[model samples]
Target: MARLTKKQKEALAKIEKGKLYSVDEASALIKDVTNTKFDSSVDIAVRLGVDPRKANQMVRGVVSLPHGTGKDMKVLALVTPDKEAEAKEAGADYVGLDEYLDKIKSGWTDVDVIITMPSVMGKLGPLGRVLGPRGLMPNPKTGTVTMDVAKAVTEVKAGKIDFKVDKTGIVHAAIGKASFSADKIAGNANELLTTLIKLKPTTAKGVYVKSIFMSSTMSPSIAVDPKIG
Candidate 1:
């Protein structure tokens, strides 16, 4: 195993071993432990007691963070000419149809979120191999595929984000950046946790949220008390 650097060792020392921190405490501690030159993203990892393999127990939904995610989301609005003006007005970084489709066909998915209309979804179906693995495929459930292209683009530009449980039953999402105030980080984390609690599947038994951890891009994970909202 690679030896830990002096800074890494010092960061790990700050965390109390076997101690579960509250949401606010963990958020603050994460910033303190982050030593990266760049503004590292603050992420939350939630372990749920549900089997993602079972459709009924799958947990997936969207939540708008009170304080916007520190990163500027690059949104691609794939709409017809009629909706081009509306998409541009909604702050979409890229707005077009066939040209953008051709770009996507030629292995060019450089945007963060792709928002398209229901009518255009048929054409996108064939490009699933390229978009699916990258988590860029527009899905109706995530509001990425909708007739209201403007609304979808605006929401994504805001702090709206979609997250789903992985096969291991862990839901991981970037809440904000380390540069944000502790309060902002805690608020975003609380909003996501509240949403996850509300989305608990009826088929899921026992503890819905098994464990919660908060950390920065390169910092050691801080154990958060799951009971704390």
Candidate 2:
């Protein structure tokens, strides 16, 4: 195992061993543990008791964090000329269709989120191989594929994020940045946890939420009470 740095050891020591912290407590403690010079991202991992391989138990949904995600989301609006003006006004960084499609075809997915119109989705089908793995595909369920291109772009820029359970049945997402106040971190974390609870598949059996962990980039994980939600 890689040896822990002095700072890492100190951060780890702050957490009480075998104690499950409440959401607010964990959120505040993560700030104290994060020692990075840069504003590290506060991430939450929820382990659910569901088999993702079973389609009936799959969990996926979106939530709008009350305090925006600290990162400025780079949005690419893949719309036709008729919608370009509205898309740009909605804070989309890149607003265009064919050229951007060509760029993606060349493996250039520079934007964080891609919002496209329903008509444009057909054109995107061929680029699925390039976008799917990156989680950049415009899915209708996530509101990425819509007639209201501006609405989609605006929501994404306003801290709306979609999450899906991975093969291991864990949903992981960055809730906020370490620079945010402890209250903001806790607010965002709670919002996500509430959304996950609402999205719990009926087929899922036993403890829907098996475990919860909160941490900042490069910080040791802090166990959060699964029932806090």
Candidate 3:
């Protein structure tokens, strides 16, 4: 195994062993532990007591962070001519149909979120191979595929994010950036935790939230109290 660096060892020393920190405490501690020169993304991992393989226990949903994700999400509005103006007005970084579709067909997925209308979905179906793997396929369930292009684009640009439980039954998401104030980080973490609690499946018995961890890029994970909402 690779040895821990001096910084990594120092970071681990700050975290008390066997101590499960509260959301507020973990939020603050993560900032102190993250030593990256650039602003690092603060992520949360929630282990749920459910089998993701079971259809009845699958968990997935979207939540708008209270303080907005510190990073500005780049949005591509794939709309018809009439909706182009609306999409542009809603802060979409790119707006168009055929030209953009051609770009995507040629393996150009430079944007983060893609917002397209239902009518445009049929055209996108053939390009699913290029978009699906990258998690950029716009889905109606996540509000990315809709007739209201403006609303979808605006929401994505305003810190709205969708998350799904992985095979290990852990729901992971980036809540905010380490540069944000402790209060902002804690607020975002609480918002995501609260949303996960509300989305608990009835089929999921026993403890819904098994464990929670908060960490930043290249930083040691800080164990957060699972009971926190």
lDDT of 2 by residue, 9-54 (tens): 9999999999999999999999999999999999999999999999
Model 2 worst lDDT run, 10 consecutive residues: 220-229
State candidate 1's TM-score. Answer: 0.98
Q: Of the pair 1 and 2, which is ahead by lDDT?
A: 2
**Tens digits of lDDT, candidate 3, 7-47:** 99999999999999999999999999999999999999999
Candidate 1 lDDT, 81-183, residue by residue in tens: 9999999999999999899989999999899999999999999999999998998999999999988988999898889999999999999999999999999
After superposition on all CA atoms, what RMSD does each candidate show versus the true structure?
0.9, 0.7, 1.0
List TM-scores for all candidates, in order.
0.98, 0.99, 0.97
Which 10-residue window in model 1 sums to the lowest lDDT?
A: 220-229
Candidate 3 weakest ten by summed lDDT: 220-229
RMSD after Cα superposition, model 1: 0.9
Q: Pick the candidate with the highest lDDT.
A: 2
